[model samples]
Target: MTAAVRPPYRVGIVGCGAISRNHLEAFAALPEAVVVAVCDVDADRARSTAERWGIEHAYGSVEELLAAGVDVVSVCTPHPTHEAVVLASAAAGAHVLCEKPIATDLAAAERMVAACDAAGVRLGVLFQRRFWPAAQRLRAAVDDGTLGRPILGHASVLLHREPEYFSSAAWRGTWASDGGGVLMTQAIHYIDLLQWLMGEAVEVHGHIGTFRHAIEVEDSATAVLKFASGAMATLSASTAASPSLGISIRITGETGATAELSEFPEGTDGRVTIWARGGAIESEQVHPADVDPNVDLAAINGQLIPHHTAQVRDFVSALSANDGTGREPAITGSDATAALRILLAVYESSRTGSPVRLNQTATQEALA
Candidate 1:
C-alpha cells in the first residue's frame, strides 16, 4: 500500500500592489501551495496579475474570490484596509496572512484577531524580516540566554525616499490611507523585531516631524521604550537620509555581551555585524560590496522575496498540519499587535508631550 499525498492548498492573493508581487512569488515557489485566484479593487490589475502569474481566476472583490474558493488568503492591501480583508477571509473560513502593522489602529487589529480565533482560522502578519538568518540568530541568542537578560536595545532606520516616492501613490503618505509615516510604515518592522527580542514594552516616549518630505505625515520619528523585563531601547527612523543609509538593530545584554544586525544599502539580508562576549569579538559582512546605493524602491522590495517565501512556507506548513497537533505561525495576529501597540503609543506620546503607557485602556484612548 502507498501513502496518500495531500493536495496543495489553494491560495488567493488580495491586492495587486508592489508588495503583492512578493506574496505571489512566495506562494508560487511553494509546491504545497497554489495561487488559484487573485482579487483587487481594480479589476484590470487583478486580471493582469492573475494572467501574469498564470493563475486561473481573478475577481474585482473579495467576495468573488471567496466564492471561487480558497484555502488561504494573502492580504497585501494597505495598512488601514487589512482589517476588513482579514475579517472577511476569516469569516469565509480561510486562513489569512497579512502584511505588517496588522492595522492602522489597535482596536481594528484586536477585532481581526478575535474574528480569526472565533472562525477557527489562523491569522498571520508578515514580518518577513524575522525570517532573516541574522534575525534568527539574534532571537536564538536571546531565547537560549546567550544574550542573558537583554538590558538595552536600539534600532536606527535611516533611509532615503525621493519626494516622488510619496507623490506616486495617492495613499503613500497620508494618515487616512497609509496609516502613518516612517514609524507606522517602515520602522514598524524593526519595532516588531525589537519587541520580539526585548520581550514587552511597558512605556513609550517619542517625537515626530515631517522633516524633509513634502507630505502630510511625518518623515522622521524618534522614540524611547521601556520593556516589561526592565530593558530599555531607543528608536530613530526617517525617510530623510540622503543617499540612503541602511537599517541596524543592536542589543546589549547584562552578561556583558552585545550583538548587532546590520542591513546595509537597504533591501538586503542583514548579518551579525558585531558580536562581542568577554574577550572575543567578531563581525561579518553579508551584503555585496560595491552595490549601488540608489536602486529603485520596487527593486529594493523585490530583494525581500526570499524572506517572504520563508514565512509563506511556514504558513502553508501550519495549515497543512491542521490535525490539531500543528505548530502555529511564528508571527500571529496577537503577536503582531504588540509592535502596533508600541508604535501607536509613540504617536500618542509625541502628540501629548508626555510618556505613554502600554495597556488596553491607553491604546484605546490613544486612538480615540
Candidate 2:
C-alpha cells in the first residue's frame, strides 16, 4: 500500500520585526505548513507573535528553537546575526530562508553557504523581485531578443528617510552591523535585479559617500558596470533623496528594447509601462501582490510577502527530496554569495578610487 502523504510542512521563525510580519503572513496563507515556532531575543516580541499567529511554541533564542522541533527556519534577524542563525539552523537539519545581503560581509555570506553545504541542508536567500509580474514582462522581452541584446540597463532605489529611522534601531547606522546604510539594507532589491537582468558584472567603478544620514555606510552610491555579455549598466542607490522617491530600472538592449519599472513593485499603486523603439506596449502583467492583511497596506508590500511564501514552499520542496534529492536547492546559498561579492567590489572600488573585476561567478570554494 502507498504511504499517506504528509501535510504541507512545518516552519519556525527567527527575529520579529518589520519584515518578519510579512514572512508570518506568507506562512499563514500556505495550506501545507504550520508556524510551529517563533524566536526573538525580546521575549515579548517572540511570545506576542506566537500568540497572534496561534503558534504554541515560542523561544527567547533561536538556539532554543533549533533544539525544539523545526523542519525549517527563517533567519529574519538583524543583518549582523544572519550568518550565525543560518549556520546553526542548517546544522540542526533545517533548511533556511535568509533575508538578503546574506550577511553584512562577503566572508560571512560565504561561511553561511559553506556551512549549509557541509550540513546537507539548503539555504535560500530572499530576492523576491525575481517574481515581480512587471519584471516578468521585461524578462520576457529581453529573452525574446526584443531588447536587441540589452546594451545597457540602469536601476536605482532612492528613498527619503527621517533621521529617526537611522537612530531608532540600535544597530541601524553602524558599520559593524547594519552593513552599508541604504545600499545594503534598502536598495539591495534593485542591486539583485540589476544582476538578474544583466548577468554577472565583470568590472565596476563607483563613487560612494555618506550624507543626509548619520550612518557609517554610504547613504548614496553610483557605479558603472561591464557585464560578461560585453553589455554595460549604470547602477545607483541612495536613501537620502527627497520625498516622492523613485524606484526604476531602464534597460537598453542592442536591439533598442527598453523596459522600465517606474514605481517600486513592492508599493507601486501606479501603472508600469514597457516602451520599445518609441511606442508603448499594451498590457501590464503584474498580478495582485496578495500581501497579508497583517502587514499594513498589503496591496503594495504584498509582492514581498507573497513571494516569500513561494520561497518557503520552494525551500520545503528541496528538503523533501534529498539524495537525488527533493528539489536541488531552489536558490542556492551561493546566489547570495555572488550578489555579496559584487556588492563588496562596488564598495572596494568606491573606496580605492579604482574599478573591481569579476570576470566569472565567485565559487564557494574559491571563497573558502
Candidate 3:
C-alpha cells in the first residue's frame, strides 16, 4: 500500500499593499502552496500584483476572491478591515492567515476568532518575529528552565519613521484606521514576543504621547505589565529616535540568568546579543557598522520574507497533514489576541490614569 499524494493548496491574498508582497513571495517559495488569486479595493494594484507574481486571478473585492475558490486566504488589509476579510474567508470554508494585531479592537478580534471556531477552519495570525532563530532560542531557554521561570523582562523598540511615511498613507497614524501608533503598529511585535516569554499579562499601566510625528496617534509610548505568573515587564517604544536604534528585548530569570535579543538595522535577522548563565557571559561579536535611518517599507518587507516564508510553510503543512500528526500554527487567532488584549489595556490604562485589569468583556470604545 502507498500513501496518496495531496494537491497543492490554493491561496488567495486580499489587499495588495506593502505587506502583501511579503505574503506573495512567501507562498511562491513553497511548492505545497500556490497563490491563485489576489484582491484589493484598488483593482489596478491587485492586477499588477497578480501580474508581477504570475498569479491567475485578480479581483476587486473579497467576495469575488472567495467565489473563485481558495483553500487558504491571507488577510493583508489595514487594521480595521481585518474582520470583514477573515469572516468572509471562514464563511467560505477557507483557512485564514491574518496579519498582526488580529483586529483594531477586542470586539472585532473576538468575533473573528469565534467565526473561525464555528466554521471549523484554522485561523493563524502573522507574528513572524517568533520565527526568528534568536527568538526561538530565548523561548526554548524559558521552556527548558534554563531561564528559571522568567521573573522579569524588558522590550525596547526605538526606531525612526520619516514624516513622509505617514503622509504617503492616509491611515498611517489614525486611531480608527491604523489602530494606535508606535505601540500598535511597531511595538506590538515585541509585546507579543515579551508576553510569549513572560506569561499571560493580567494588568498594564501605560502612557502615550506624540513627541515627534505630527500624527493623531502616539509616536512614543511606555507600559508596565503584570503577568499571571507574577513576572513583571516594562515596554517603551518610539518611532521618533533620530538615527533609528532598532529593537531589543532582555529577559532576566529567577536564577539571575539573563539573555537579550537584538534586531539591529530593523527588519534584519535578530541576534541573541547577550547571554549570562552560571556566572558566564556571552555577547554578539559582530555589530552593524551603521544603522540606516532611511530604511523603507519595501526594504523591510524584503528582509522579512524569510521569516514570513517560514510561517507560511508551517501553515500550509498544518493544512496538508491529515494523519493525526498535524500541528496547529505557531500563532493562532487566540494566541495573537493575547498581545492585542495587552496593548488595548495599555490604551485604556493611559486614558484612565490607572492600571487596567485584563477582562474579556472590556470593549474598545475607550480607545476611541
Of the candidates numbered 2 and 3, which has the greater TM-score value?
3
Q: Taking the tens digit of each residue's C-alpha lDDT, what string does model 1 give over 340-364? A: 9998888899899999988633243
Q: Residues 1-368, candidate 2: write the lDDT tens digits.
A: 11112456668899987788878888787777788999999989999989888897999998899888777788888898998899888778777888887998877888888887787677888877666676766777778887756678887766666677777679788888788777787667777777777777778888888877877878888988877777788888887776525577888887765777765433543234557565656445433345221222334455467667666666665665654425554556777777777777788898899989875864544323
lDDT of each: 0.88, 0.74, 0.88
Where model 3 places Cα greater than 4 Å from the true spot, the runs are 1-6, 285-287, 291-294, 360-368
As a whole number from 0 to 100, the lDDT of residue 300 in candidate 3 is 81
lDDT of 3 by residue, 1-368 (tens): 11112448889999999999899989998898899999999999999999998899999999999999898999999899999999999889888999997998988999999998888788899999999999999999998888878889999998889999899878799988999999889899999999889887887999999988999999999999888777889999999987887889999988789999998878998899999999899988434665554478778889999999999988887776644565567899998898999998888988999999886443344222
Ranking by TM-score: 3, 1, 2
User: Higher lDDT: candidate 2 or 3?
Assistant: 3
For candidate 3, list the clashing residue pairs, or say none.
Answer: none
Residue 93 displacement (Å), model 1? 0.6
Task: Give the CA lDDT, 0 to 100, for residue 211 in model 2.
Answer: 76
Candidate 1, position 314, lDDT:
90
In angstroms, the error of model 3 at 32 is 0.9
